[model samples]
Target: MLKAGDKLPQFEGLNQDGETVRSEQLIGKKLVIFFYPQANTPTCTVEACNLSDNYSKLEKAGFQLLGISGDSVKKQKNFHSKFAFPYDLIADESHEILEKFGVWQEKTTFGKTYMGIVRTTFIFDEKGICERVIEKVTSKTAAEQILEA
Candidate 1:
């Protein structure tokens, strides 16, 4: 996992609309990049909606939010549209961005081990340096966690 002060890796991803979004575009502003396991899951939905609910506050604080998951563009589009989220959701089906950020990992459930994304969030400053890493994310208060961090 990346720690505070580490430089963010250069990455490009496809957003819900199939538009290319590159890390360079976010370099000049504070950014919140969150990795969720999948789209439309209960926990993920709560987390995303919380962020969306508090989006104005986050924007007011100069933070741009991006959500990523191993879902396809069509799935991402549906998720974004269903929730009416104001931010973009990256369709990282290849796990390129997830692996780059080190969120893809071995997870355990019901005594079974499997590879999946560990829900995590990274805060990057204007210069693209990681400022904070939130590994224990509170799904319902994600924006508050970011704002308070």
Candidate 2:
């Protein structure tokens, strides 16, 4: 798992619009980078909607939000449209960025085990250094915690 003060790894991936978004491009700005398991699933939807609802507040606080998932760009587009998400959703189909951040892990539920993304959020300072990592998020108040952080 990445920790506070660790330098973010360099990576490039596609966003919902198929536009290339590079990690280095987020430098010189505060960023809220979040990782979720899948698109349109219950938990994922709630988490995403929470962020979408408070997007103005988050942006007003000078934080740019970027959501990453293993879904393809096409799926990401559908999710964004369905949820009316105002922020960027990166399609990390290869899990390259997910692996780099160490959010991909072995998980088990209902006697089923599989590799998946553990809901994670990284707060990066304007200098592109990690300020904090939210290892497990299970509530909508996550945005509040992030804003307070």
Candidate 3:
């Protein structure tokens, strides 16, 4: 898992709109890059919605948000539209960004183990340095976690 003070890894992925989003574009701004296990799931929805509900506060605090998941662009689009999120959700179906950010890992459920994304969020400072890493994310209070960090 990435920790505070680590440099943001170089990455690029397609957003829900199929537009290219690159880490370089966020270099000079504070950013909240959240990694969710899947889109539209109950917990994921709460998390995404929490952020959306508090988006104005986040923006006022000088931060932009991005959500990344292995869901396809169509699914991401649906999720985004369904929730009316004010931020972009990247379709990282290729897992390139997932691996780069170290969120891809072995997960177990119902006695089955498999590789999947661990719910995590990386907050970066204006210079692209990691400022905080939230690994034990509280979906219902995600935005508060970021704001109070």
TM per candidate: 0.99, 0.96, 0.98
Estimate the overall C-alpha local distance difference test score of candidate 3.
0.96
Model 3 lDDT tens row, 49-135:
999999999999999999999999999999999999999999998899999999999999999999999999999999999999999
lDDT of 1 by residue, 1-149 (tens): 77899998899999999999999999999999999999999999999999999999999999999999999999999999999999999999999999999998999999999999999999999999999999999999999999997
Candidate 1 overall Cα lDDT vs. reference?
0.96
Q: Candidates ranked by TM-score, best first? A: 1, 3, 2
Best by TM-score: 1
Model 3 residue runs over 4 Å out of place are none
Model 2, range 1-149, lDDT digits (tens) per residue? 88899998899999999999999899987999999989999888989999888989999999999999999999999999998898889999888999999999999999999999999999999998999999868557768868888
1 or 2, greater by lDDT? 1
Candidate 2: pairs in clash: none
Query: Which residue pairs in model 3 clash with each other?
Result: none
At residue 93, candidate 2 shows an lDDT of: 85
**lDDT scores in order:** 0.96, 0.91, 0.96
Candidate 2 vs candidate 3, TM-score winner: 3
Displacement of the residue 11 alpha carbon in candidate 3, Å: 0.6
